[model samples]
Target: MSRVKESIEVDVPVRTAYDQWTQFESFPQFMDGVERIEQRTDKLTHWVTKISGVKREFDAEITEQIPDAKVAWVTVAGEGEQSGLVTFQPIDPTHTQVTLMMDFDPEGMAENIGDKLGFVDRQVKGDLKRFKHFIEDRGTATGQWRGQV
Candidate 1:
């Protein structure tokens, strides 16, 4: 098991940040390794990702959520076993600090090699940076899903 974490502060509201994060399908706009995300249900999501030329598919179940605050999820099926959380902390009326944390294990050969070489860490940082740019450019989220499980 390996843990990779990164964070970035976005010039947006807490709710804005949270809402944007909820749009799983929009992840590809910032998340480099992600190819697509399907919001299957209120608490379920399917993901297809290609990283370092290796692709994998997975499903995750939202474990916990707090409006305008945080979202957490755990992978339930796929080639990866992991869990992660994204939290939105308001710095001001128009600024929010987004923090992301994930715990995962490298599954196949490519992932294992990539992880041991710090490739995964660098990618995570890159992803966060992209996310910053993405949210900043957008100014507001596309939509929000606030329903409970």
Candidate 2:
């Protein structure tokens, strides 16, 4: 398994950042390689991704969630095995620090090589940067789910 941890500061409140994150379907707007995400339920999400010409589909179950704080999930059924956590920290009334941590098993030769070359780390970092722009530009969450998991 390989692990990646990345963080970015966005010009938004913790609640704004956290609420925007809950809208899973909007991930494609900022998350590279993520073609689509479907929120099957409050605790389940289906994902479609294509990276370096490889396409994959997966289901991830939210293991923990706390509004304006953090969200965690593990793959339940998928083309890959992975788990991740995202946390939001309030830097101030109008700034938030968002961090993401992921653990994944690289499948096959190409994935293994990419992982070793730090591809995943770069991807996560880029995604967080895009997310910063996405949320800061919007200045409000597209949607929000406040339910506990």
**Per-model C-alpha lDDT, please?**
0.88, 0.96
TM-score of model 1 (CA atoms):
0.94
Q: Using TM-score as the measure, which candidate wins? A: 2
Off by over 4 Å in 1: none
True lDDT of residue 7, candidate 1: 83
**lDDT, model 1, position 28:** 96
lDDT of 2: 0.96
Off by over 4 Å in 2: none
- Tens-place lDDT per residue, model 2, 1-149, is 89999999999999999999999999999999999999998899999999999999999999999999999999999799999999999999999999999999999999999999999999999999999999999999999999988
Every model's TM-score: 0.94, 0.99
TM-score of 2: 0.99
